[model samples]
Target: MISGPASVRERRLWMRTIAIVNQKGGCGKTTTAINLSAFLASETRRVLLIDMDPQGHATLGLLRDPSQLEKTVYEVLTHEQGVTALAEIIVRVRENLDLAPADVLLSALPEKLRETPGKENKLSEVLEEIRKDYDYVIVDCPPSVGLLTFNALKACTEAIIPVEPSFFSLQGIARQMETLDLLATTAGHNIKARALITLYTGRSDFAKAVAEEIRKHLGDRSFNTVIRFSLKLPEAVGHGLPIAEFSPRSSGCADYRALAREVLADEPPKFAPSRVEEDPEEAIAPAPAAALEQAESPLEPRMQVSPPIPVIGEGLFTVETPRAREEANSLPPAAVLEQAESFLESRMPAAPPMPINGEGLFTSEAPGAREETIPPALAAVFEQAESPLERRIQASPPMPVNGGVRFTIEAPGARSVQLAADFNDWVADEMQSRDGIWTKVVPLPPGRYHYRYVVDGGWQTDPLNVHLEPTPWGGYNSVFVLEGNNGNKVH
Candidate 1:
């Protein structure tokens, strides 16, 4: 059981809930749901896989016998007296992973709840009670459009339609997308839907052509990672174990891990407000007196201030802007700024004095000191410094020594931190902490790489590193380039 302080769990408004839906069977829908949930759990996230399909394939995939269970999602959704709590049916299947098994009885849920009010929201209401307990919930929908699928769609904020590389699969996806759009409009909930190519055979020309056609039609709406055909996948499923544990080095495991990384790189989809019926009289009501008075007044002209222009001196001193100069002059004579500057000057390396010209403040000779000394108080102000030299100094990029680079970040209150990068195949490696500063060292050859820090199950870019590139998922990845015995931060 993954438990945390109430305060910590409450940091997220709701866990990311995704429903795997496809009206067409044998399209790898159940396979994607099971494997994706497993890989996400392996990434140190608490995940729950709910088998909405009465066939109980997801439960069996995790090696559980749904028939022998005392309770399952069927009881929770269709109980006569009241709905059963979701927590009671949850069974721990693996580390950081749980399952809500289903059996043949779940197939009767549609008829049982046909006359019930708000029947389509039964699953949604049940999940709302424990939404903060897990990081993700994966709902495996049955291979048909019915009440179960409606409940899954109503409860989820995102949907993934897994399609095999074939013309039939492609044709099925169009209908699936249409259904998703109709649900989103009628339910007034925005759902982010993506297409994933599964069961792909890279060597086959037909498969390659179909994959290309899917990509061209979906554009950025399709996943880049394709689930290639692998014999080991079914073997793992038969054993009721994830590919990560059964065959860690198999292509099936590699592809799923890559898919999990892509999922983590993106932020959770935001939930849209549901449609509410309002009276026509209230919809066009006249504005209140106070609102009307405020709107009638002329809008104030906003003041626009230009950015400060930097002027570098012989000792790398920067001149303050006119507004800054006035603010500094207003301070007390014994202000801390003067004392800090004096302390920094005393600690700086010795440099040759330059003759200052009267009018243009020209320097007769360059300073011998190669680096500028920054005052403690001024460091914060220089955070947005425009000059390359100033920015580099402020960033304090990690240096590579003896073919190893030391990665460090200060996260004062984080429970744990891990490093994930392309060099490690995107598997998060636990980082050690000392005095709230997390550190890790990885050996690498001369090459460029992108990375991110996983702080307490949340993906974050290194705060100290200024170099970053935008990810396709609407987030940034910190960039690092190792050259010889030195490391350079790059964008």
Candidate 2:
């Protein structure tokens, strides 16, 4: 199949397809699917939520009663010519958001496709016809693996697995990863999977500990944001409305927004690495000094340096001087007597001195008088130092009026990151990442500018900068404000 755009203008309108799946029930799979989709749509982008499950929880969660719907996903999948009239079946849940409803009739999808050839690719084919119409398409998969789930897997570019903080859910993660591996081998589909923690109660020590364990094992595959448990979530579902619409101020709404921000920050997930090979001899480590010296370079070196020896107490025996023997032979009788007297004096203890408050250097009527005035000698020293003849005027460094703006970002997985914005007309001026950190300094006049990091064909906001401007494309532009004033705050 052909991938990427045929023209430069057409490349900006590409779509992302995602599937939310987990075999375990009551793990908040459907909840994540609905809320995440709702938050993305809230950003003013066209989003389609596909309810592929027969239970139709995603459909019910979005205020669409499956019983009242005439043509649902069940009909869309069973009919041979249903792909042509998909627009008729899809209902608009709200502005910039649409839903392809499903009902219990969807449970019979497997038997319906039993005799059909290439059933696995049927859903992918159907979605291909309308994929260009929206920015994102989210598929809500069922709890069990079957023809329906396989079709969804074939259609999706990425998968999100929601897991609860419990032992049962923790054990299910390995099985899910194994299933993805098998699908990749048998079906030739590389679907990127990310594990999300849902229904997390931060107050529970056991839950927090289990969540940390899952994150430690999953590494980068697990999301940084945890969807906290909130009573408003179930209440919103019962009312047949997404949390954004049902209770906008609730924790459920805040958690989903945070999740959406993370989703927008990432590039298209790389499901697998490409083929590459190296010789055994070449793969072996070089000398430590050579490695450390050429660490900034991309390729590994092939030389080694020997270890250095210690200078102090590094060997078994100590060396003696000849001058010490001559001094020992020349000792006198009087010197011996003086050494004995000194030794006896060192062994004796000395008496403590008396208090000098009213007896010695300063005999003042009150203790405050000593503290209030410095000694005459010290006062003279301070007076000379404070004199204008001794004072020096130091020069200050000049403030930056207009100069280069150093833009840096760390993207270890990216092939190359380019600075694209109004300054450069969004061109891919390549910048190489050294030690996983990419940097580029561009000279510009002091003013506000909007920019983004385009890493390996994926556009992302600057993670280092908190100042952002929402774009019409349902994302953001990293904003930088440089000023001539020395004390100006950065944006």
Candidate 3:
């Protein structure tokens, strides 16, 4: 199931267990875990990305198809063989990056662990044996507060809560903090949490204002590096590679690398984490003094009126931010682009000529160097030949089709059409189809909804929808917004 070097050498390193969590779905929890682990590993640190989420998004995103794998996190957690003995389940993604995969079967984990004693400490106990091998353990938590999330928090020393730049995402922070307080009190786990602004498009006054407000409320907890909204981010996930491997020049790659550096700036503690033996009948330790203070404090009140940020972009491509512009100068220039060129040439067959705009090339090489460095014909292949799957989200603006929300996809031969979305726990719902077209309509409420189409058995995201996010399953999910009765009111 893995494709890399023979087993990585075990080294004595201080491990930092980080939980990338958010109660809200579609907030880049999986995305952050995958890429941040990738970037950290790129710096030569041994990183183990634990796919704690039952959806197995992090597993699929790292190029491991969960359906094809025999052993997963489900088997490890449910069986008597803890993570220390289940070394085969940890697949190597790259040189220093390893993944403990999870699958749909993991959905049954909570129930299985419920009757088991020390349920919340199971993950922590398993990790305690294996944490010494890696320099970092990044846990991708599910989008809810339950035993799974509790186990992740209990095992982690740090938490990275990704917040989308929106009113709802901003408002949910208080509840998340409360949950952390409860965990600290009951589980005796003191975690350092940092608020990371993800899917952030800094163009609008409203988005910027909301982000600033979150930073003000969170204070030192918010990360300085913001992941700019990039179409490339979702596209990378679809390609089943990290942003750096998929498109090193993309803004998504730059932002994640910066975040990695920020996370590593502080020297990790030299001491090993205290290994607490689980006692089934024992009472929980008292809450820390800091947690008591947090429980008593209220969220900082907002002073300015929040603006109505559109659910999706007005246009196809987003302009690169100033930070991205600065980062573009130093991205692995010739080596990376050359690799991409060779990859495209070998992988893709000839299609209709779609000329690439020369100005769009992300590089600073001289004209003579550009012509001589890589063949002009090969360079054209890099820009042109964008596939239908890759460019689908840019096809049209997101707008309600009928009285209800309607989704359409173009597929030649499909027996059954289905939809998987947030509202339905991502279960496939059958749709109507005629000729080479498929369509589905459902009455959705006035908030943002993320969805994808399942044509026959094959999965396809809405080509027409521009608002998109990365799924744990290594693809993009289409998002659309329905304006509430009060047009610009925040949810």
Candidate 4:
């Protein structure tokens, strides 16, 4: 593939999505959807809530107007459309929450349902194209479990239902379960639904009894945290602020926070995505640094990088990582191989003959048996090219000779990095190498100089240097000492 700008890769990594929905109307679904999304976004998790409902409540809750959207999810999700092409349509409503705005045109869904084959998975198809852009995608569903609701359920990995602690809410569980089971088996999306009790009350006997009844029905399926009935919830919705920002100190906000944490804590289920054929890249084992760290680290997927070079010959060069390819780019593979062979050939000097002896036991020696003469020219080159990577690696600095200073020593990655010393006013840095080596000779005056390596445009500690101290975030920092307090150079 052709190279793209780096920002394109950066926009892909922000994700961990959950679509909040309930089939029944008047179940606090929209309130839970927007507030939980807003609270999660407030926690610094990048979120995008797709409002699949025709009522456009989630859209109106987040945006100034829902029907006014010129390029809504309806158009943006078309086969001719994609996220990058429609990113301009996705408006930034709050800090990290972006809404793919929708309007009431969806109210006609029942009439047009199944006009196309497998219409339920349309949203899923579009979402898969841009799954990397969000940490959490909180989708708000329409009340009737219509075509739009089916599409959202098919697209989302998990679902959260805000039940109003009423008998009818529990009664609807059977129908909702049937929908989830059908989508999981037919559409190949095993969507998990986390049931949450909304409009909870502590003092009222009827509220307590209703909450207990719902829990008995749900058992471990319902979330442990109950959203207490509070006036702030409705007020926040009317003002278009998430309870977290509107009335953060209220119980409603706290309940959503706890529920959001639980939802975030659940593991993303492993399901086989619908595909006819898979690529070698998808089948290959993921990089341990990235895939294994997914649950722990916040790294997004890379935008563009070439595939690893297939190992050939004796495998002298191991795996082709981002570092190896970069260094290899400086010297083409053909040139590198040519140079290595030449260096090896230089070592195979012509065989020499042994010395002649006297009288009866005299033996004649051929030139092959004679002693070989060492040439100064060949000897110097031999020493300099001892290592294959040495063409890029710098040699050790000068010793404690006059004006030689052991100001500092450190190196990080192998090609094209920099280092700055406190002795140099932390000015321009000397370049570092890609073969994991660096050496610099500096004429310094007196005092100890603190130094650090600036690698790949970022300030970092040297992997080779030992004098390290803790910096911010418990990261290591390199410390340099100007021994003898005189102008000198040391490796």
Candidate 5:
């Protein structure tokens, strides 16, 4: 809809360009790109999936016959004689989702563009024309690194490297990361690269161990959503449909949806009113000098900016120490409230030496003989007492009521929390939050269960329940046993 270069530049600011790249084959790179785009589009976002891979797996996965296509991304990128618009090759795959299909002919791109001066920037330049048209542009790179992959890296602002739970996959990731770092240093492009664990089978000890190692090393850099191995996934692709359409109830569909939500969560907020007057062209430019300076090293997370304030209220009062403020800002609302209560308790005397009036008010005795009563509303605010929810969570482990187990965790500051357990095939179930406590009541018969909590995209064992079992990977999982109708904490 945006016409001319200026309007395109303005629209590009809101668009998220992501390239799915992995030098290793059979790592679910194409599958991730296709399904992720489909799920994103299902969420009411306009998505354009560009098949940069010459093999055309993404195109075939969407049921688009590349052989019949007169125009593809290859044609648009080559532009042998005259310029070919990317929109001309795009075909609608689903509602709100479009595809620019590719075929084996694209494999010749490197040899053709080798003589071109700005060949690496071809995809980047071509994408500019339709930058304003879609909310997301997902590029499916070839399995091997070449000019095509370089073009993808050059164009995208974010990259996802899908690493399956295999020894070979693990070895390849280090090389893949090195390539990304090389590009960042040489090209000076700021691309936020993240590792996605795919084709994971939790039942296999080897798979679990590999996954744990990836998480341990990557930490927050790796996605918390793991794509569990599913037979329905390959079957759906064979049927020329995404897992969501082919088997909506399948684990494959659920995992991809979770991945899409994780990606959407990281979307940057829109520019403030004050930044409206800034030049649009400059917004799409490479990282500024300030951003570069913030990065301690190229391997570290780039473009380091102060984390956004938590949704909870601002600090209780002006913080005197930078370290204290930083620690407070990182804490969830529940922790912050506890800290405030402790601060209040430390400042107040153990006994006020005041008398309770007939109206249940605290009356202070003074030399002037004037009765000063504490207001009920004001007094309630200053009360250093735990809420009923907090007390219940602290007093008991998951309680079984009405043939269901109620799991609870105190994390008031977390924007979202999910419970994943072996009983549910490790699929994360959203938990409801009240005050600073999160609870999920699941109906279960007598059985043993292993579970973990995912808070704000970080996975961890339940802190409340000390009884934990060591996992295959050097981590722990909380254990709970339901005997008859009553729940028992596993020792």
Candidate 6:
């Protein structure tokens, strides 16, 4: 069950703003925003949820009455109304919870925003006014890549994207990254990195597969706590309550709370504001913060708007941004291409051609240098195992084994799967599979035993865990892990 909030005023001291943004609809962007805000509120962290979407799903979910507001975030953005103090419009939900409701007004704000100067940074400016008032300001962005999304990107320091595990989800990340890059260059003033993975189904194989794909791409960016699918998630939202409050006992609530802790525990995001001084470069010559400025030269009588500036410090400095691949000083395309011929030759892979004259012997100084670096490959052979399979292939208790502990396999499909460990010396293999699951009840005492599972005379890794290693064919293999090794305390 969710813990009751302590107090609102006691929590605003640790305010941290976050924006939940994803252009892909049904990816649970609003759901994450609503639930995460709710979870934060439950922790007594003063949360101000901004429903920036015109659809107002977050508004309707949190509000008893949607049309009651006279002024919304929409009005604050456009309508010549400066949003100086945003806390005044906060709709109090629970003790620590407040919301900035949105509806039809936000839909009209976009059109009006298009006509204004410095249009992209309107929301960022407005939120800056209210940033220090609350512990967290979670903005719910619309389900599209438009001006509204851009504004949301500009307003927040970090972003959480909810991506459903499906075919389209991976491709959508590219567009999202491009949009984030656009904002970083233009609208994003103090914005940091933006990333999140959501709508995960831990029970389904497809979900796990997709999650693995996402984790590989995101690498360190992906959160460790994964949210499993549950029926209770929608019910909480339908009741106009946070998932933690409405379905406190549900798995969905637990997942969200875990996600909250992960989010809160993460390092705060930060982006460079007009290129600050990095370490090594600073030692040679400190770079100046050249805001877009141009100076006229008195030497030219028929001078145009501004004198021509060099690439670095000069009259009208056209700051040449470097490509992602280039780490050197900024240069034009011609310079990159001119050096590309040599670079391309170095990077290109060489392949042997078929011999026509049968005299194509290419000799090397040492044949030892050309030897393959990869280890021997091992293939996992599946033998009908349990749903949650446990194949203890080895157990090494160099000392005496008590033999009371019983391992379990939850495979519903297989009627038989045997678990053998080296502790028994493969003679008295204690654990055997039953009811599509394998269980070995034994007294595993103070030693390490390497174990694997034999299912229907075939070998396979455990479903619940994974072991990462290089394969024999210059690739990698995923392995499952079990704890309690090398005199470690047993769970």
lDDT of 1 by residue, 310-426 (tens): 335543334444545455446664353433222221221111111010011111123342223333333434334432222221112344544587787777799999999999998
User: Worst lDDT window (10 residues) for model 3?
Assistant: 350-359
* Each prediction's TM-score versus the true structure: 0.53, 0.52, 0.62, 0.50, 0.54, 0.51
Model 2 pairs in collision: 287-304
Comparison by lDDT, 1 against 6, better one: 1
Cα lDDT computed for each candidate against the true fold: 0.65, 0.61, 0.63, 0.54, 0.66, 0.52
- Ranked by TM-score, top first: 3, 5, 1, 2, 6, 4
Q: Rank the candidates by lDDT, best first.
A: 5, 1, 3, 2, 4, 6
List candidate 4 segments past 4 Å from native: 1-15, 78-88, 109-113, 267-491
What's the true lDDT of residue 217 in model 1? 89
| Cα lDDT of model 5 by residue, 123-236, tens digit | 999889987788889999988889999999999999999988766777889999998889999999878989998866443445556767887788777887767655456556
Point out where model 2 deviates above 4 Å: 1-12, 80-84, 267-491
lDDT for each residue of candidate 2 in 1-491, tens digit (9 for 90 to 100): 11221332342266778899887765678888888898777654468999998777788788645578888877777774454556768999888789989877888888888998998887787787776788779999988788888888889989999987766678788788888888999988899899988766433345556777887788879776666555456556656788777756455665676677667555333311121222222121111232223233211121111111111242211223244334433656344333222221111111011111111111112312212122112222222333221232111111122356666676777887887888898776776666676867677775668888898888887654433555787667867654443322123
lDDT score for candidate 5 against the true structure: 0.66
Ten-residue region with minimum lDDT total, candidate 1: 351-360
Better by lDDT, candidate 2 or 1: 1
Off by over 4 Å in 6: 1-14, 80-85, 187-190, 267-491
Residue 3, model 6, lDDT: 38
- Per-candidate Cα RMSD to the true structure, in Å, reads 21.0, 28.9, 15.0, 26.8, 19.0, 25.0
lDDT of 5 at 252: 67
Cα lDDT over the full model 4: 0.54
Per-residue C-alpha lDDT of model 4 across residues 36-60, encoded as one tens digit per residue: 8886666555688888876666776
